[model samples]
Target: MVDRLRFFLNRIKERLWIKPLAMCLLSTASVFLAKMVDVTEIGQIVPLITLSSIETLLNIIASSMLVIATFAVGSMVSAYASASSTATPRALSLVIADDVSQNALSTFIGSFIFSIVALIALQNSYYDKAGRFVLFVLTLSMFAIVIITFVSWVDRIARLGRVNGTIDKVEMATAAALQRRRLTPTLHGVPPGTHVPGGRAVYGSLIGYVQRVDINALQKYADKTAIRITVAGLPGTFAAPGRVLAYVTADLGDFTDIDICQIEKAFLIGGERKFYEDPRFGLITLSEIGSRALSPAVNDPGTAIDIIGTLVRLFALWCAPIKDNENIRIAECDRVEVPEICLRDMFDDAFTGIARDGAAAVEVMARLQKAFESLATIEHPVMRDVAICHSRLALARAESVLKIHEDIEVVRRLAKFGNSV
Candidate 1:
């Protein structure tokens, strides 16, 4: 029973070894300091006579163990920090683009400091016996190693402070997703009878700026103005993909969990970045323009002539049944009419100028006929609307210009010479 009890006592001591070692080290240091003050004997109070060979041996073992543990912790933290910024990518390419190796350096510095300090403790013991002195030196070296490694554990915890922000962000997103799903899963869905703007089969999900707005009840919830934003795959017929389309207000909570960085991955310049090159979309494609397309460089006067001519012919063609059989010799005065050009410039100059300059109804009507006659071959559906809308908008603006045509000197001069009579 005595032998068994002794074995049990040893096992318990072994189990509780680290705490006792720490206590012994602190106590011995305190006693040494007391002896330095000339107030205590070499073995008085602290560490309970720790100048002994047995105590020196125990100290050496304890220090070695601490350094090993600290080093292990530092290595693990270094690897994790490296992976976080370098390996895991986000839509914002620069999100974690900063240095990953910096964290590893931090662990290295912290552990190094702990190791050196503990090593000094090992070398400076006040023991009288040579065996105990040797043991003290070994103890100091081992303790330095353990302290350095243990410092890494402290570093691992410190590093967590740096990463706590990312964790909080992720948590916020997850919570927002949960809340939106619970409150309104159909928040982004379309209204009755109308699909999303692009007529796409499935819009998956989206976020967009309200470029233009006509909301009746938007003020009830949030801002009533339109905010134009360029989000991924959110289409608008009235707007090109990047064009600001409307003013709108929406739920802030609904947008909270949205990963805007994910959407940026779909673009070369990023969703936030501007267009690197001008895109004519399908308007400038080959089917309409052919290999070499026409452009407005051919003639500036031709739009006014061509637009007016097309309208007259339309009226003539619609009114006179026999005109279909007749070949009209409307001159192609515009040397620059391109294959798919909208002639926004022409409408801006010719039609709007006429309307604004107070041109007579008969004169305005005549010039419009001439402009349409100038380029009568375009017939595609949307492009045709482009022309029609430009003409209409130009005319509206021209009428306004006519009211204030005196405010525009060049317009007044052009208006003076417009009449062929």
Candidate 2:
């Protein structure tokens, strides 16, 4: 339930309208509340604050903010287009969901709505002396917010659509997902191991990616029914019609449609995979960027080399165990089974695309070999083996692509090192 709720909240936060709508509600309430306070009662104690003064200020803000909002929208559209053309399309979502840009636009639009509401109330004689003072103070505070937000937005908009900026955002998101998975390798459950005894398959009704899994809810159901549920497909796995979503083992009775539906509900199926808790998707996006960089039209080896370093840092973090303070402790069922992400699969996702597209690029291939060698320094045997395998694959591709002996010799020397002296 926590994982699913986190995923849902992330989706809501990414939407461009959610923040503005929230600000609108707050703006409406502020206007109404200010009007309810009778300012005349406190006029003698607090000096005179005229409605005309506040009204004039609001009128100026109200008129100017509409144009500003229009400009902001236009800027956002241009940024989106720039990101799509320069970076991989997969990264466009990160650019769109940028908090600085979204908050700036929301602030502009929200301030406009507030000013308009205040103007309407002023024209309707809704403000008493004290009410006018309250609105005046609120408007001044808003002005500060707008100025600060605008400055930050201006600084951010300069680079928000750049390829490097987009890559950083994806890397940040991926690192967060990887950290969460590190804490809960089995996603807060024990590993199901290879198979389940007497486990019957539960098929999915739709065809899509498993975006989220409500493990807490599933555990609750398992406890109630005294059954063991093993999740065959982790988040980011593709599910087709009648494909096995999970396996159920219980002595009570056969699986009913209601039970199957309940299982399906725990797994949030979606048209596209999400980066919320899917590290694989993040690696895939990074690889996509590398592939795009290596394209004949782009022919940017530096970008691909940069991504090699990024993947190395990510894998290093993944190899390290979570500290006691860093692990998120929560109540989870012991009967439920989940599959941990395989080390080899991550290597495949992070390297294959780059290898395929960057084979001929000596700089990229050398960097790729160095990255695998770095991962080989880790203590895990599986990680070392996977790194070695990918290094060999990359070396072979470099051998076939490089017509020059010097370039091939460099790659061969690095591969021979094998992550050790």
Candidate 3:
């Protein structure tokens, strides 16, 4: 339930309208809230604020905020487009969810709504002397908030859609997902080992990517039915009409249609993969950005090189040793079996495209080799092996593509150094 709620909240955040809508609601509420000041004894002591003063302030906000809000929307749209074109389209979601931009937009729209609502109330003579003063104070506070938010937002907007900023955003999101998975690799379930018990395969009715799996919900159902469930459709897995989402082992006869529906509900199938639960998606998106940079039109090896560095940092998170207290892996749902994310798959996602597209670029290959060397030095045997394997693959790609002998030699030397490490 917790996982499901978190996933839902993440999806909600991605919607550009959610914040603005929320702000509008609060703005409307505040206008009515000022009416309570009229009933308070403090209203008698407070100096009377003239109706014209409050009206003039609100008129200023009402006249200007809509235009500012429109400008903000246009700026955000351009930023989104810039992110999609400069980086991978997959990263546009992260760009859209930027808090500063959203807050600024909300403030602009909220201030507009507040002005309009307060204007309507003032026209109707809804406020007493104290209510008018309270409203004036609220208006001043709103103006201050709008000014501060706009200033911070301007700084953030300057970089929001740039290639480097987009890359940083993707890296942070990927690192967070990787760190979460590092702590709970099995999603708090038993590891699906070499052998999984045979059971009735439960296929998803919908076709899409598995965005999230509710392991606790699955465990509860499994406990009720005294069955073991092996999850096959992890997040990022493509699910089709006939694809098996999980294998349900039950002593009873086949599960009813409703039972199957309930089990499938535990998996949230979405049209596109999300970064929240799937770390590989982030890696793949980063790789895509690098590949785009290496394209003939872009031809930006520096971006590709920077992406290599980011991948190294992310992979290091996986290789870092878990704290002693966290070394113990306890399966919160013993009846549910979830396969661990493959190190080989992560390697392929992070490096394969860059290796292929940037093979002929000596600078990219050299940096790639250096990144491999760094990963090779990690103490984890699996990480070392995966790093070595990718190093060889990238070296082979480089050798095949480089026409210059010295360039080939440089990559070869770096590859050899990585191997030795």
TM-score of 2: 0.95
lDDT of 1 by residue, 261-281 (tens): 332332222122110111111
TM-score between model 3 and native: 0.96
Worst 10 residues of 2 by lDDT: 251-260
Question: Could you tally the backbone clashes for each prediction?
Answer: 57, 1, 0
Looking at model 3, the pairs that clash are none
Estimate TM-scores for all models: 0.19, 0.95, 0.96
Task: Say which candidate scores most in TM-score.
Answer: 3
Across 159-206, the per-residue lDDT of candidate 2 in tens digits comes to 888889988998999999999988888887777766543577878888
Better of 1 and 3 by lDDT: 3
Q: All models: lDDT?
A: 0.33, 0.85, 0.91
Q: Where is model 1 poorest over a 10-residue stretch in terms of lDDT? A: 285-294
Worst 10 residues of 3 by lDDT: 251-260
